[model samples]
Target: MKEKIESKLREKFPNAILEVNDFRGDLTFLVDKNSIVEICKFLRDDEELSFDLLVDLCGVDRAKRKDRFEVVYHIVSLKNRYRVRLKVRVDEKDCVVDSVTSVYPTANWHERETYDMFGITFRNHPDLRRMYMPEEFEYYPLRKDFPLMGIPGSLQLPKR
Candidate 1:
């Protein structure tokens, strides 16, 4: 089941960096950040593989990678009964990926939440603002390097 979807995705997106995480039975593909919108459109609309559901979109911060941020798209095909995960890496200086809200309406809020936590800007995401975090917080807390507690000069920690 996974191989069939992978082959079709390869045929459809030849340049996408494709990988099969067989240990967990997940189809993971990485495409250039700029091509995200195009790739997502193909996945959702292709007749043979109608991945009509955008399950989630989020970011993963790779502390060791030169490109520090990865935007991950979790998609499911209700008609075909298949799933795939798409990833695109972006540099910390330019942590941005194309928004898929136009293709999948559900992506709007997901993108906002991702942006709020990971600081990966979804270009053209409608209402890209902090969904759950306080508005006063200036930095994204989910990045691997972001400090959980401030240094000594800052507020005191809760009693342990």
Candidate 2:
């Protein structure tokens, strides 16, 4: 099944797939960021693939790497009972990626939360805003560089 999926992806988008891995039955693909939306659309629309469920979408802070961030997507084909993990590397300087909301509506809240916590923006998101933090807050709390003590006086506390 993994071989079939990889072959199809290669045939459709030759250079878009950077790497493929299968570890302990987990299929993973590291793909080009530029073609992510198209890739996702194909995954869902392809009759043989039919990855209908977007299980999770997340932002990872790889603090010390040249590409300091990664956007990961986990999708499952309910009909085929197979799962795949897709990853796209994102540099800190350019922390935006194309949204998958059009393919999977559930990505809406996940993208919002990732933006709120890790400060990775989702391009073309219907409503992209901080989920937990105030609109005016400057720091991303979940960032690796965020101070352990919290940003002093960043959030106003109401008097008791």
Candidate 3:
């Protein structure tokens, strides 16, 4: 079943460079960021693999690794009764990936949360504003190098 699905995906998405891995029960394929939209379109529109649900989209910070961030897209095929994960690695300095909101409108809030927490920008996202973070936050707190302590005495809490 997995082989057939993979073959269909490869045929539909010619530019999608992927590394298939079936570790234990988890099924995932690491793909290039540039081909994300096309791959998603194929998944959702293909009659055989009608992945109608975009379950989730998330960002992971791999600070120690060369590829600093990875964006994970989870989709469920209602017709095929299968699930798949697509991952794309992006560097810290240029952590920009194509938005899937056009393919899946439910991805709006999820993408916003990812952008808020990890500073992974989704290019062409219609409403890419901070979701869970204070608007005044100058930097992303979830990053490894973010300061743990408060700023030096600018607004100290009255000797408490």
For every model shown, the clashing-pair count is: 0, 0, 0
> Which ranges in model 3 have alpha carbons more than 4 Å from their true place?
147-160
Measured with C-alpha atoms, the lDDT of residue 100 in candidate 3 is 95
TM-score-based ranking, best first? 2, 3, 1
TM-score for predicted model 2 compared with the true structure: 0.95
Where's the lowest-lDDT run of ten residues in candidate 1?
Answer: 149-158
Q: Record all residue pairs in model 1 with backbone atoms less than 3 Å apart, i.e. clashing.
A: none
What would the per-residue lDDT of candidate 3 be over residues 37-109, giving only the tens digit for each residue? 9889888988877899999899888889999999999999887778998999999888899999999999999
- Considering TM-score, which of the candidate structures 1 and 3 is the better prediction for this target? 3
* Rank list by lDDT: 2, 3, 1
Model 1: number of backbone collisions: 0
Winner on TM-score between 1 and 2 is 2
Residue pairs with clashing backbones, model 2: none
Give the per-residue Cα lDDT of candidate 1 at 61. 86
lDDT of 1 at 123: 85
Cα lDDT tens digits for candidate 2, 48-148: 88999999999889899999999999999999999999999999899889999998999999999999999999899999999998999999998899988
Whole-structure CA lDDT of model 3:
0.85
Q: Would you list the clashing residue pairs of candidate 3?
A: none
